[model samples]
Target: MTIAPSRSPAPSGATWQRADWASSFRNVGTELADVAVTASRGTIPAELCGSLYRNGPGRLERGGQWVHHPFDGDGMITALRFEGGEARLSNRFVRTEGWQAEESAGRFVYRGVFGTQKPGGALANAFDLRLKNIANTHVVRLGDQLLALWEAAEPHALDPHSLETRGLSRLDGVLKPGEAFSAHPRFDPGHRGAPRMVTFGVKSGPRSTIRLMEFATADDPAAGVQAGQLLAERHDTMAGFAFLHDFAITPNWAVFLQNAMAFNPLPYVLGQKGAAQCLASKPGEIGRFFLVPRPGSAAAERHAKPLEVPAPEGFVFHHLNAFEDEATGELVLDSIFYADFPSIGPGDDFRSVDFEAIPEGQLKRCRIDLERAATDPAGAVSSDWLEQRCCEFATVHPARQGREARFAWMAVTEQERGNAPLQAIEKLDLSSGERRVWCAGARSFVSEPVMVPRAGTGSEAASGPEDDGWLLCVVWNGARCASDLVILNAHDLSEQAVLELPLAIPHGLHGSWVAA
Candidate 1:
């Protein structure tokens, strides 16, 4: 397939300005109650009844001191409830232990993993290996409970309706104290029984170990905690430190990409830099792909070990989708790759970052002949670029996950090339390489788009057309210094409604949609 640049033009009079974009990073200190919001353009679909929950860094500064990186800020959640052709918005902080302590003392009391240090310099930070769980990556709902997730620590359970913190949860003893639970969880539309949620946890050291877990969805009320029933768990250990943030899955396999990077903890141990800053990418090294057979699968009984294939030379953070090609006997994986590790150096200002200096993420497709990989691992993998444009946070319909999906929607840069803020949402047809885009004007920025399929289209009974849905995203309107909830037709990138929000939300990481 030959992909081309989008021909759809930006909104009239749209122009990019750095100052306008930078205004979105300000700290928001107030928690908002349910505020009635109406669409300023177009009309809300009457059938659209669900809740949109988003998680991101909400506070960038404290006690006159600023966080070195936005990732270090405390977590804040924004919830939007759509019902009867109207919407209500609410925002609240996660209120983690660290956030509570900092609020009580009115200063920075703990060091952050990304580079926010304590007030007393190196003497106060040295030898302090304790990490503060900011709970600021993603928000997900499992059965009747909602969780605020931070990949480095246990998740903090929140009241689904009020957005109130209910303290940290161990998933009914599935996770031990301080165990890592990944923020990225893939929902598997059931093939045999009921739909399940698949997620993993990693422990990195001289040798890294990955623990894959599957839980029953809300369909099973008798499950643990009325939702997250642990179905199957498996572990695989690999050589070298694994800096894994996200992964992909299919019906029979759990896939992971071990990027070509090394971690040096000297700086972090000595209070000179954050733990994430210690990672350095190897220039000419190739990555390795680990395909672990899912527990209770026929492949697990046949092969006692995972199949390792040589991946292309790049760093991957998120995957669009993965599937097993039954006819070709191959496993295909689609992901976003960066040329190298993206980082902000110590003592540098993150707000004034130069987009050109860092590598832009591009979508790529990798096909691995599983039969060949079992015998000849080195020659089993081949890959090519799917979309060369700068993009991230791509999603397909939930029902199409771990299957052949033809359509995908993601946040992309407004320009045809080069790295910049994601100012638009693009719909791509994988087979035909056709592209459609809806730019939010140059002064606006977008978050990850969540595709909510129209009710009754795709479910356990049958998988419908991929694009029969709506794309819900939060847009930062720089012109008005506020945010807007924009809903667009998934099939064609056209605005359906734009509900003006009362407050501005910072650029977020990830979000989810829960149907009412």
Candidate 2:
């Protein structure tokens, strides 16, 4: 973990300009201000003070209709709820402004926030959850009931504490129009306690399935206005399956990553507008990895079957999760993407629009073995990508096992760059592949790493209640756009405590802590 470079001086900015097609790009912004003052854990502010939501993208209208991008939050905070220690956020006060985005047409999207232990008091008692379009994924509370799923071109169900809607389901035979519904409506929480919903569809055309629906909530909302049985089916794969992102489930098993038609991305955003006739019949994202099993009976269908993982003829594996390791029944499968960097050049725009030459991606650990993947769930156990440097945002800190199953992620190497800078925050000792970086450059864009367990210290015969894990995180500091919260020391993330958050929280994507 060697990060030394700090001659400082380069944080000025018009957001660090450089986009009109890269113009020869090279603004590592003073090694990203010495990797945010060495992964900042204390004083590091200057100007960039946080907050930047804007949500508006996905469009096509003009009568062709494709819209769908609403989630507005113009006031700020788009969705953050850390619970107990307090963090509840949801800004954008009811704005929608139609959708036709040429690039985020009207902006202002927030979509969620619902805390209650009295942190800042009434923001309508916290529980807004917007989205007249887009906003699909991660609202799910189930157990006190709070859930949402929308695609706008029709497919709704909101009411995470009164974001109110409760029913719409018109996939008109099942999804079409520019397709966009990546499933995150998951919740199995056990049999009679009731809670099960899983949706995944991203088909722009022929054959691309993964639909599993089942909502429950009936006590007679007028004989049925919302909840209970939509049961929608569809899942019989292998035919060059089309796009199907992130997935992970375990009440038996249900994993996904299908992508063949070149792992489609809407033909590279319609080939960046020139609409190259369909980019030679599309195949522009490169994909592979499909494993499904989990329906019931026969020992849970022999522990869920259906497997096919094969890639390494050009690389392409993004996000995917499932980490069940009950005394080695083994299922660990984390992921990450962006490849090609044999020294960068293809399309070169300064290593492809500054994503910094890709490669610096890897952290694959597989060992499925569910009764030999139930007869070849892709031939069970074996894979790699175990860290070669240049990583980005990895996470797996649910705290488990005989300790030592922690991972923190967020690296940069080559002495940090700018506008994206993240320099260090490692920690992966998984069985002994050893790694440790406990902070190196303050606020370089962190956001995901919430463990926070530390209470009694576990083991009083183990039933569930003995703490020792703290990690929490927020980082950011994009030249002071502000952000800090840190808390480290989950068995030594280098013992820390930063805090400092009064406001300035605009860059968000994945978050959830709940341990109040």
Candidate 3:
């Protein structure tokens, strides 16, 4: 089914400007408890019942000092609950140890990983290698616990209902203190049996080590089994510094791309620049794809070593999905690739960043022949462009994860090309290369779109069309000076409802949908 490219028209008399986009970064100071929200445009779906949780850097300044980057700001979580054709909103800040300490002192005592330094000069900030757990990247509900995750440190647990902080969690002792747990996790729909969650952590250095872990879900059919019980764990060490943020997985293999980038921590150690700003791409360097076998797969016993295949020149922060083609014996990976690493310099203001100056993420498809990889590794991999437009934060139906999928929903730029703020939600048909977009307006901006399948359509007992669902997205209403929860029909990019939010949520990094 081919869907021709089309876009929803902007609101009458609405004009887009840099200031309109910048207004979304303002700090939301107050927290609300169960505030009812009303739809301003359409009626809410009666069948849609669940909670949408989002996390991001909410507070940008403290003690009259602004963070050098938005990523350095404090983490805030927003919960939007829908039930019986009604919705209520609530938000709270995760009270990490660092957040509590700074609140009591009423000053900047910790240096941020993204270049927010204390009042004292370089002497005071120098050589302090302690990393404060910001807990600002992503949120996930595993079994009975809700965890706010940061890639650099342990996740902070919170009450799934009240949004209250429950302190740091060690995954029931699966993790130790101060260990790195990744923010991005892939949910496998269980090709073999019960579903499982797959995640990884990295300890990067001259020789980087990656620890891959899998956990059983609370929805397992087994009686009296606890959620988050570690199912499998494996550690692998590879050459070179690894700055991996996300990875892709199939039924049998976990795939990671090691970008050809060099990191120099001298400037960061001297308190002159952020740690991320110290990385630069290596010219003429080709990336590599590390394919590791899963714990209980057919390839696990025979291939105890990870196979490395040459990758195309680019950097990937996120992958859409991956699947193994049974007929061709090839593993297919779909990912968004940037020409280079995007960084904020010491003097650059994130609010005023030039979108055109940085590289845009374009989606690409790569196919690796497993049989050929065992012999001629260099020539086993091949790739081509899938979507050459400016887009990010893409997702497929939960049931189609790590499997062949035909549809994807993501936030995209309003224009056909070039880099800009994401202003619309796009539904792309991967089979036919067609797309449909629903734009809020010229001045409005958008966050990631989460696709929630309609109940009983696709589940363990049955299967349905991949696009039979709803797309929930948080949109910044620049004209209203607030935010809105925009809901669209997954079958077609049509507005189903728009719940006006009293408070504006800062542009978030990631979110998840939990069915009640």
Candidate 4:
């Protein structure tokens, strides 16, 4: 597939702004997809987290490239901020022990070609002993401390402003043995109870199990962590499920998603033997979901009954945003899923991996309509997953603070053998289960569009009146030249605006928006 040009015709009745960092990479004619955005402080690096805070649609202003340093790891840039003409970013990269590239075995050779599983031929013959630098699960800022939970690595204390690791919790027996952990961080501002910390862990062994933990940030800092009292734990083993992708939390309930690790699919695709041989499994694997009570309360149970989710094997997730609907106390979850593995194989060159088959990617919406999970909590996925052979890489956008209005944006590709070519952005109505492709072409693959709320549309229009509910998206034109950012109306997905950057961005991952 050809990477589109970095320019587009401006859309009607829509306004767009291109940041400064979108012009650095030379788009090498491959569609730049999987673009995610977030707001943060400090220089956002070129990797996933750094790119989130990248300046869109402009030339890299001298030191802009310096924002994304060499050390940063893969994590979501969920938040970002740009002020005084400088961009700052913030997010957590899980740090796990013995899980780096050096630890991974030699690259997996399929059909005489090699796919990068790790750097070395084998750990015994490898040069770097450190393996790969594992990242953090999910982290959030609470006053001065940035609380993050990891299955294998130590829980780090980072300065929210500088994004530096200042201290770490001496995690000893609390960490369960596994390939990785699942618990993601969330900020629960106290409304009825004290603040709580929620996390999940995957314990690996003959039988893999998923564990959930909850604790408090304001508890006595001098007091040593109490395994039974300081946290709540839950375990489950259906299909030997352990790995969890992303999760969502409401005031009273927490939602869990399994196997949502998008860009980090190396371990899963490499098989358990490959994973164990190389220490690729950090904590969580085989994505599964659970629901537990928020930490720091009288009702806290030592091991809360984890309401399981309906995530199946071989389906990986990206993120899950949970919200409570007024009409029903039940929680609604919006998520993105990669239904099946693309039959990808490495070419003679490392620059590209070819897909053996075209993926019919899909976006799914599931609602937990009961107080407790009925049937198998591990089976909470929507019915669509049972039918579609393949699904798209998708992002969920909630509109007007209502679940009914939530939208799912996906880039569904045309199926090929090893890798299917991603084609267009299909907008799905969560409530109706209907989908529409606002923009589609074999030459292009659209990233998650930035759903910008127009300002002063009486705050209810909330997205702003400038375009009356619109989406500002970076559409990568597959042209040999630069790429483009196109804005569309969120309500219609039909009206569009194109903003052309002066240069092309090399194929990258997620990015976010910053209101200047």
TM-score of each: 0.96, 0.28, 0.96, 0.54
Alpha-carbon runs more than 4 Å astray in model 3? 1-8, 11-15, 219-224, 460-462
Residues 31-114, model 3: lDDT tens digits: 988999989888899889999999998888787888888888889999999998899999999999998988899887888888
Which residue pairs in candidate 1 collide? Answer: none
Taken over the whole model, the C-alpha lDDT of each candidate is 0.88, 0.40, 0.87, 0.41
Question: How many Å off is the CA of 254 in candidate 2?
Answer: 1.5
Model 2: per-residue lDDT, tens digit, 86-140?
3333322112222223125333222221111112223422343232343432334
Candidate 1 lDDT by residue in tens digits, 1-516 = 222222234555566788878888889867888988999888999889999999999988889999989999899999999998999999999989999999998888988898889999988888899999999999999977799999998999999999999999999999999999999998988854678889999999989999999988766544433468888999999999998899988888889999988999999999888899889997789889999998888778877888889999889999999989999989999999998889999978988998989899999999999999988999999898888999999998888888888888889987778898898888888888888878887678889999999888857426566687789999988888889899998888678888889888988899999999
State residue 89's C-alpha deviation in candidate 3, in Å.
0.8
Better of 1 and 4 by TM-score: 1
Q: For residue 311, what is the lDDT in candidate 3?
A: 90
Query: In lDDT terms, which candidate is top?
Result: 1
Off by over 4 Å in 1: 1-15, 219-226, 460-464
